[model samples]
Target chain A: MTKPDVLITGSYPEWDMQPMQEAFTVHELAADASATSLPRDVADKITALAMKGHAPIDGAYMDALPNLKMIANFGVGYDAIDVEAADARGIAVTNTPDVLSDDVADLAVAMLIAQARDMMGAEAWVRSGNWGTQGAYPLKQKVSGSRIGIIGLGRIGHEIASRLAAFKCEIGYSSRSRKETPGWQYFDDHVALADWADHVVIALAGGPGTAGLVSKQVIEAIGPRGILVNISRGSTVDEPALLDALESGRLGGAGLDVFENEPKIDPRFLKLKNAVLQPHQASATAETRQDMGALQRENLLSFYAKKPLQTPVNKTGKSYPR
Target chain B: MTKPDVLITGSYPEWDMQPMQEAFTVHELAADASATSLPRDVADKITALAMKGHAPIDGAYMDALPNLKMIANFGVGYDAIDVEAADARGIAVTNTPDVLSDDVADLAVAMLIAQARDMMGAEAWVRSGNWGTQGAYPLKQKVSGSRIGIIGLGRIGHEIASRLAAFKCEIGYSSRSRKETPGWQYFDDHVALADWADHVVIALAGGPGTAGLVSKQVIEAIGPRGILVNISRGSTVDEPALLDALESGRLGGAGLDVFENEPKIDPRFLKLKNAVLQPHQASATAETRQDMGALQRENLLSFYAKKPLQTPVNKTGKSYPR
Candidate 1:
């Protein structure tokens, strides 16, 4: 009973930590630390592991925690987790999704408009005392009423499309199959969708099947007047192709929340005046992150109560429904 | 026939300049030039003056252009022109309003989201290579579903409300008079509206009557969690009260387009991380500006054609409808 019951591998907000600490005997491990470095007593008693968005947790990590029953993920996308491995070991995996959709979608729209309107440059013009000395920032393209192509019509994509729709934008999308949605035009191929759209947004699931879905060909089809927005995983877009296109002025601009090998993202992107860079903070809003932490805790509480997991991504040893 | 038919007193997009040159014998004057500075021959021949959003055209300026029959403004706000002065001289006035409403409203929404999500800091965290080292950015408030209070219920405000509606935000407004709208909560006092709202957006017209409408009391009522978004005019807000609140952490943050002494904005704002500054580019979108130019041209052309004006904001002598 004295051993810590949970391991919070990734960090959460300080406001969320107090409640989490009160509810469970929690042990925290630094995000950069390997699981093998965990103290034996702490690892032996750990029943659940809490994770944020970007961390690779495979079977080897699972083996490090012999008694681990569930992985409570703080974000919607669980692509970084080896769910198949979790399932094979009868370990339940749960993720926080719907709670963060509005925040993520709001951010996607914000980034798109910020890029198209030259918000960053406009701000700089004012902050650098240039507006008085030089002149108004140059005019930028309007985001409203443009034909938008959405890649992957999943929950977050749908939310982004819905918000943009209110701006009177025409919606088009490329998903694996034609969805029941009637207003949005669907394309079987990403390239065709890009060609048809004035703007393209990457919202596909991030996994082996969807990696590099927005290829060089697809980006080229988007053309110069086109803006691209990505609120999904960096793996879903061709980072090198995207960088080249943006630098060469083949693509109009980008509003990116993710990047391949992010944090250590290509330094070339730093010099780009056309891109609006965000550190994968689509669901980083305090309101949404708090909700996500609560949901993660909820899942853990449900598992301990012997109830079907709240948002189970995979089935686990007789605890979740098959 | 020897008279200059149209005098362009302000700069316009090059795309608009070509058409004006073709349609009429044009006399161009620098925006900085006082009307009296124009050569007497040139000033005497001017039949109509084309104006942009800024650059004052007072009675003295109007008095200089004796043959000026009309003033066709390139922006929705004709506040820069002394309408009383124009009317006394029987000068017809028209403005480009609805054409740029979507673009302005789109910008207001974008600024709000960017401020709430800390897009600027997040970008720096990644570009400066801190995301890998510092872990993640601190969480921020969510924009979607927050109670948003608009200071005006005019066209741009209505447009902003419609777009935010899709994000599921609860909309409230304070206007001169309550409108026929049903769902939005109405508070006649700006202070009352701020007290109830999580965020307040300024959409009120800027003028002598509307100056300092967002007073110290109202801004304080919005409190620490409330964000202020201003797209309307710098005069509408109490800039010093706002600056003090933001610096003291009494008010949460701000997304400002217009400033009290813009260009020469308060240097304190540049140091605050809680601000998103723009150089009044709400309608500075290429599509919208082009459309505005076309509309301004249309008004000037209509005056020349003796047709009922397109968007007459005020009337003049025998040529305009009484």
Candidate 2:
């Protein structure tokens, strides 16, 4: 039997690509590749799209692949993919979630402690012979028993709160609705949570509706002694407001894993010693990434076999006409 | 009555010093200052010593302060002060403990996750615009749900284990005796624990008895895939063997907060990319340090009042001649 043709719409690890090449007729596109980048014949043949990164997949892009029945997103956050558009055209959308939650939560906690304790500064003190020349590294604030306000109580947010509880942090969260957590305080307003938090971690989903969820008012509420950690999408936060707060010491510090225009993040972030910047790598662990790839492939295989999708985000009422 | 004369044997934070100066006749000495550093008249008048850092306080050194009755150490570890010599001379010795355990544990967990995740490398990628110029930071190993071995299960070690447990790590420990922990595996031997652990943390107290406890064999047992985190004294591990392993990739990585000759640590440690070096700052936080200072002072104040010392490490049967 002829293998089904699939178009990879972003840069992926070689581990994911190698096995995928063996099971399917694979076509590649750059992470920023447009519909025009593909030949007319190849675009017509692609029955599925394996997507990664933050490149937007709109209705127009989906229309190019006429037979495309499914989009298997590599990571948990599928905000970049317009689920409404995919549903309108009967394209089943499946995201690799739960698998990457542990890794993301681990990073959220790591960044919180790293920034709180100034791990990089302390490392530099030892490496630069400053411990010998200068005295001890300047004392920083303690992380244990501090008030932690989680901006969203989703899977990733819950995981972060669970880990921090062992550190004796008082956990509070602001979500659309209350979650069944063990005595974690819930807030209806983002600004209220930020005001109460010694540290605030952003774990909300991204998209137009949630854009600027952490607004200027929220940033101001997370006062000078407060640390903001964002492991979620850059769209969840107001980057300019965050930058201004960090620069002026209006916000204590930030441990950001994502930013607007990431990779090419605002140069202002580079100057602030208070921010712990990272290349959107919360789920960027070899073990977890491999698992993610396997899950992504599983969804693709299910799509071709006419079996039910494993973890679909949107179930279209109508079947694909393929 | 005239204020009791007390000599501060090491440089301390102003928060600690300010209070000490107000209550007592404060005499200053550098961290590395010796008996000869203090004027003979001042040494003769000194009744108490407030100590910090790892400066040796031997029997001969103690004899110089003819009126010295007690020594109050700033940190949890009292190995630097000769307790045996103090006992012989009937000089009361006290150290601040329990108060700094949370901060030390926080750093231990921070360093463990930092090294495992290569947090410094990731931050550098963002800061140097490598994330934009190159691509994603290289994938690291997953820290959550890994097998962790705690070498000592004392107050600080227990705290570290407790925090890591929330990260979903399988906790194993090697202590002289088994602790009543909730289902944490216990190994009687250090080598066995190292062999079993994905990561091993050394939290044993530093002294002659426990010196070089994490031997060359233990380092070898931890193997190439294992990471070592030492928040305990540097004297516990074989530094030469550790360096060799780190350089050769026989050991995966290390997160060191203490070293044999810190400040002037072996130049080789500075060269290893796999090792996360810190300037012995496990308990160096503003809130914790303030508490430590208060505890140390409480012991000193009790000593001058002819009351029982608050946190004495050595019980000198005889009262000081002073």
Candidate 3:
């Protein structure tokens, strides 16, 4: 078999590349590699593009590599890759989905409980000699048996809801319409769900139409006693509004794994005692990432073999698979 | 009818005191109020002693209050009370149990996930501007689906096991004997259970026999990469051994709610990044505490009415009801 040359962009675990190396002549490129720096000879032969969410994979970049047949995203979200542009060029788009859901869901619940119990502050209380000096860490809220509302009842959201259900939490969700899944109460409007919930978790897919979908109104609707947890994109929330609400005690607290600018999160968030901040690492468990990397490799191999793609995001007409 | 003078020898929730004041002529005293400080004539009138765990209710102290009829403990684990002395004196000992189990279990699970996810470090990474500067936070171990071993499958341990079961965690337990609860693996030997589990949680009762139960041997058996969570009494585990193991990487991490000398804990545990230290606050949630306070009040009210105590720890020879 003539190994299809794959142009790998963005940073991944060094260990995860062993199988990629075995199956293809992989070209390691800086995520922001300029057109001139792109190896001209390798570009002509590159059939598959492997990249992370932070890496740029736009139409112009795809056009540069005319032989590109598919773009295999390392993580579930394909927001980094312009799906419409890839579709226009007849390039198949694939994301490692169900493989990473459990880790993401676990993280969502972990962060939620961390906030509910004030684990960060509680730890600080012990570390700073406060427990010994002052007294017990002040009482926080209980997480189990509370009402939880999940926005976007997708794979990751369902995983979160399922796990929370085990905690004896009342599960509700918001989507375009009611999902086929029974036992969960569905709200048409996101704001309505927030109003009815003790905690609102943002789990919707990130992209153009979804930007600021959990607006300031939804934040207020959830009220001061309610916590907002985001394991999804920061763009889905009105970041400034959230900051204002959190700072002013208009909202109770937050357990955020994602941020608006990311990495360069707001400086105000650093000082807030009520917030439990995390880097966008919901699925960054060693085990899950290893599995996701394997799945990404499988998607590439399946595309090359002309078989059905394991997890397709878009219908690139001729090469599309369920 | 003249009210029975009650000496509340310990701090309690301010909100809870309102009802206590209404029900009886409450004489508030410091948790460590000496035998002499108790008003002279009131001692004879005092029918019941409402105290917390820190307030000593030994035979010598109980002798000071000759007319004392019962000891109503504010929390579970009446280790401070000389149960044998109380039984010998024919004075009932009542503890607030079962009501606080859910909160304690919730905290155990919360701290477990916090340790598994490195939530403390993850939050710091975001807060200190390291997420943008240093890239993604490093991958951590997964909590869900991991093997969990619980010591003392009592009310709180049972709650912890039930919550973990929702996360698909494989459950094992160690106690004097196997419990009625099926589906959970049982180990009579504590060290054997620790050796088999990825995580070990302490939920045993605190006392002399149970002291150092989770000893150095059991900690070594858990080995590295295994997280230890203690929601039980600090006396239940050997603290010095735990500190040594955590410091030397003999154990991967810990989520501790108790210490050998609480509120005066050993300072060595402050700097360990892998640890998620809490202030012995397993049942410290506001909602749970409120419920616990209400239950304590009920026990006192029931005692005064010549009715059976609500949550009795030992028989009093007189009024004893469910």
TM-score of each: 0.96, 0.97, 0.97
Better of 2 and 3 by DockQ: 2
**Could you give the candidate ranking by TM-score, starting with the highest?**
2, 3, 1
Q: Measured with DockQ on alpha carbons, how good is candidate 3? A: 0.78
Instruction: Please report, as a residue range, the 10-residue window in candidate 3 chain B with the lowest summed lDDT.
Output: B313-322
What's the DockQ for every one of the candidates?
Answer: 0.81, 0.84, 0.78
Per DockQ, the best of the predicted structures is 2
Question: Candidate 3 on A162-238: residue-level lDDT in tens?
Answer: 88887788999999878877599989998899999999998989887799999999999989998999998988999
Query: Residue A217, candidate 1: how far off, in angstroms?
Result: 1.0
Off by over 4 Å in 2: A317-322, B317-322
Q: What lDDT tens digits, residue by residue, belong to model 2 across residues A145-210?
A: 999999989999999999999999999999999999999999999999998989999999888878
- DockQ for model 2 equals 0.84
Better of 2 and 3 by lDDT: 2
What would the per-residue lDDT of candidate 2 be over residues B1-322, giving only the tens digit for each residue?
Answer: 7998998877777888888988999998887878767889999999889998898999888998988878999999999988999888788898999999999999888888888889989999999988888988999989999999999999999999999999999999999999999899999999999999999999999999898899989998998878999999999998898999999999999999999987788989988899889898889889999999999999898888877777888766124223
The alpha-carbon lDDT assigned to residue A162 of candidate 1 equals 95
